[model samples]
Target chain A: MSGASDRVPLPYLREAAVALRDTQQRRNLATATTTIRAKRAAVTAEMPDWEALRVAGAAIKAHTLANLGHYLERLEERVMAAGGHVHWARGAREANDLVRGLVRGTGAREVIKVKSMTTDEIGLNRALAEDGVRAIETDLAELIVQLAGEAPSHILVPAIHKNRAEIRTLFLRAFGIAPSDLSDDPAELAGAARRYLRERFLATGVAVSGANFAVAETGSVCVVESEGNGRMCTTLPHTLISVMGIEKVLPRWRDLEVFLQLLPRSSTAERMNPYTSFWTGVHDGDGPRAFHLVLLDNGRSRTLSDDVGRETLRCIRCSACLNVCPVYERVGGHAYGSVYPGPIGAILNPQLRDVERDEALPYASTLCGACFEVCPVAIDIPRILVELRHRTVERKRERSPLPYGSAEDAAMVGAAKVFARWSRYEAAQRLGRLGQGPFVRDGAIRSLPGPLAGWSAVRDLRALPRQTFREWWRARGAGGGATPGEHEGEARDG
Target chain B: MAESARNAVLAAIERATHQVRDADPAAAHDALTRGYRQRGGASLPECLERLEERLEDYGVRVTRTTADGLPAAVAAWVAERGVQRWVVPPGVPEVWLSSVRGVEAIADDAGPRELDGADAVVTSCAVAVAETGSIVLDAGPGQGRRAATLVPDVHLCVVPASLVVELVPEAVAGLADAVTGGRPLTWISGPSATSDIELVRVAGVHGPRTLAVLLVEDA
Candidate 1:
């Protein structure tokens, strides 16, 4: 919420490069990503019209975001009309404060939470802790992260980096148990988490969550989860506080048709998620007596303003992009160093914060376009990344103005002068081909001695071939008795 | 302290309303309704089409039938699956089951253990969706409580054609009076599924593994 603990302006590119070299992280990521990718492909392939549906889904979100302010107001009014309360927050601090105030009002000293990335983004748990209220994570992976006092690495699976043995250690140390007694089997671990959370769920009077989708027509908030913990959190508590992003609204309950299909397959590669709980306002005596909806803006409006980047808002937080990303797989989620960790985070975090502050993030992608291909909402992520890179470059240029006679400025001016003419361009290319002799080592430039050292640090650059394209063209023309323009025409025809 | 906190939130909402008034409330409301209609909600047939597309996308099988043949079809499905015990929602029409016999039918009010032990659960939907192939289950007489449909391994929901709505707005509008003035509502799209860290697809995580929807035509 505060700028003080916002992501440190550390050298993320350098750190990510180092992390990418870590064999264990790479292995874990490759295995996990490949498996998820295959599963998603298999599931999505079953639908003959998946592509058409994806296009429709993207168009709907784009249209909604274009008229976001109107929809948000409609959502607020509808919720109120349904006897539900709506709270608007400009930023994370306001959102967190609103939630804490609601919890405090309930006279609740502790609260149980369903897995909500929005809460993590706003640092809600930490804020609640500061106010002397304990917030317990009910989701298995989230509980492991909470016990270890770490930020979530992956959006879907928070403690994804930690293996079963590591989880056993965390549970043993945090809850006072023996690791030897805890089995690595998922069922056993899940049973243990269930036992651990049941007491908190039953005892807690207030529950906090993030909504997967909020229907504006009925003012009903829907939460879809694989575990039944969300159902318990939503239904069992005396009061329910749902912190949702402003972009999460669907106009009517029927709009859920597209997303209900898009989300499950893209997220967990499932036909349908296990538990989808929808609640409107409050129930007399069935579930929560009091309900509050905190609509969080927190940089969303800023993201919405950018025509190139606004498509990122359409994300359902499915994490399909993350699962297919080669870059995300190697570095894991922690390397992104944000609550949103993966391909989506890479482009999103930098834009949400000033590009100058989180500058290293935009360059963290390989531009393979896997994320774009699999994205349910059709967010052209690679295009956005390139645009962000241009923005970053412009910001850098603005920050450090080049003097007229400086070497860097002179070189830029000189290049502009030379690039204006075909003769000069051909001369430079010829010289570059001739100049490659010394740097060429067995046809590859493995090391660079100067300013280019950073790029050569991790990857080898290919050596320039002996003949320039112009020279080759000239030689081929001599043999064929054809001019370069003719050769271009022939190439185009072929 | 509790009263003060409530007052503070109420005050905040009041203040927010006065702080920003860029758009006309009526215009904003109309634009939203129109936009929502354009996005996914429209006619019952459109909604049903969307539901069928979504259901097939999610790997759920859907069948269309009339109310008279409903019980016979379900019985055949039960026989095919070798199911011995089937759970039926309390409000399902007597005519729908008039032709079926031999299988044990547990009422919707059956305990969680009883529902869990049944091979299948069949109930009439509070509302049927054509767009998402989803069935809405309010705590109505036939639909039963949330647990009955959820705890069973196989869930077969019957939706009469007349109950289907094209868009979420229609669905919400259809249920508005009931939800605001009547009872608790539940909207279900498909069967339950999950994918673990290994990305292994697992069915029946916390709810039914197989969800079969029979869209019954009105007589």
Candidate 2:
């Protein structure tokens, strides 16, 4: 069985910083993100009431989460009444064990898998492998990642890190395609994947899936996707096991109206996705004779306890935040070392794994608020990032010997104290100018001697002004703020 | 083992969120302001227009037919597409396949391999969404097993005008009973497609690569 809690590798910053130098990775990310960004914008613009849909989505999820116990009970009853089995898993190990037992009951040595983040989060493939069952990824991007033996870097596009040429090369090595016969064309590569996985789909007897949404009232599970692989995995198999995070449950089937509009536009930027498969339990001589729904909690209950962090549960896994994240565009997803990455990962990983384990994550963002802008559920990601950062600092403060904390923490505390009072701020401004005398060159501080040096290394930093904003406001007659910079500078003095 | 885990998680959620399970769903739902439109408020002709445009946008081929002409339309399209064999759902109207000649018509009772061997699968839709250009099958009478629509390389979904709705919510509301009754539902919009490779869309992935929708007029 897989471990219950997923712990991210702690070198997020170092690896991401290193990856920033790979011009090719940067180019791949920039091109992919830009294309998705433009498409999302165009589709969003087409719907005049997009914001209304977002608000409705957030409200529905909030209501579902609030009454989760009732819905869970109701869903269990309905699914069981419909001749399907329901297994509740407190964490990943329980989920994996349940799935393994079910698959074993079917006597299947291999299974086809739909693209699911929850499966990745729980390391389900590894657990299946331990049981001598091979789980093949059918999504083209996921297939590429599986062949390359790399963790998914992006949620929507798992192989977004690789360009056409790299994928062509990987396909040549992995799929046994002759090098000269393969080209760096996307359509050609996709055709090769379709040909390769089609046989597996026809052969596999068991399918393991992760749900996009599970309607409580209907006892139904929904898997939305662009590729038909999800359909193949869900339909062809005789036995189907769906492992879903508890937070994925929705109160009603009609609630899909709001999500359907929000998810496709927010995720793939399509008016509608290619296929959305929804199955309620097992059918008589139809698809999947046996159906199993595993409700997985993992660390979600812990996350739900935090008022500020709980909004992470509202996420639909659309990855709109990732496409717009500046940091994600530069460093890519591998650096996060979590199934989830980008702006959502920065806040979500820390909460799922807790602040102490993934402390470096909350600091991964510049708090640009682009993620919040595009979030379909109106998650307020920037606010959560700040809250997680505060939680991280608090934990550090409690762990450290000094009341204030480390050198960087001490500097922040000192700055806060000075900023709390106007006289202290002016005094500090004067002190900063005087202290920068040694480092100042050509009206800028090109580099610093100590901890602050890291900031200036990547970009030129302008020297501290000779006069503070308070001084400038005073000279501009304080209230006379008609000039352009006068009002903005005066606002800063507040 | 399962019950205890289920209870534990439920208890944890209740304790952490401080929310009881007894909240009245109707009251909560009533309080919610679903600021979005329930329907596109388009005329039938307008909706059909929008549906055709949206379907075409997704690379689906949209064909029109009268109540009495559906079989001929289906047959002609199958012939034009060079389909030598096709499968029909058990509940599909026999009259619709009457004009289909020179091609073997198989039953839905076939296995996935047999279905996959067919050139195309034809079935009727439970509902159609105009705004999103979607056809939903709840595995009802005319619609066969989910595999019938999925396994074959081509899907020809016959949507009657009576089943067409102007918005997704309208179509979803119509399926509420089926959804609650535990029927398998599949929503198809165009053919199977993916934009995973460099964010460039390529159609005909894993599901039926070609989707042809026959919009039949209401009797």
Report DockQ per prediction, comma-separated.
0.15, 0.73
lDDT tens per residue, model 1, B1-219: 333533443343334333343355444334432222323435655556666777766557777777777878877777777888888776777777676678888876565457657888878876755544556777776776665676677888777777876544356556656654535566666665434334433444445668887776663
Q: Estimate each model's TM-score.
A: 0.72, 0.90
For model 1, the stretches where C-alpha displacement exceeds 4 angstroms are A1-9, A175-177, A404-494, B1-136, B142-194, B201-219
lDDT of 2 by residue, A80-162 (tens): 88888999998888888999899889889989999989988888998988889988889899888887778889999998988
lDDT for A455 in candidate 1 is: 57
Where model 2 places Cα greater than 4 Å from the true spot, the runs are A1-10, A416-494, B19-22
Candidate 1 per-residue lDDT over residues A1-494, each given as its tens digit: 23223445346666677677778767766877787789889878876567866876786676666666656767788777766788877778888888988888888889999899999888898799888898888877778777777767778877666666677777778766677778766656655665676567656889999999887666778898876678768876778899998889876555565677788789877655655677778765456778889887777776776566458888899999999887788788877778787789888888766645477677778999999999998999999889888777666666665655334446678799889999998887678657656676766777776655765766777666555466767788788455556644543332
Count of backbone clashes, every candidate in sequence: 13, 0
Candidate 2, A185: how far from true, in Å?
1.8
Residue range with the least summed lDDT across 10 consecutive positions in model 1 chain A: A1-10
Best by DockQ: 2
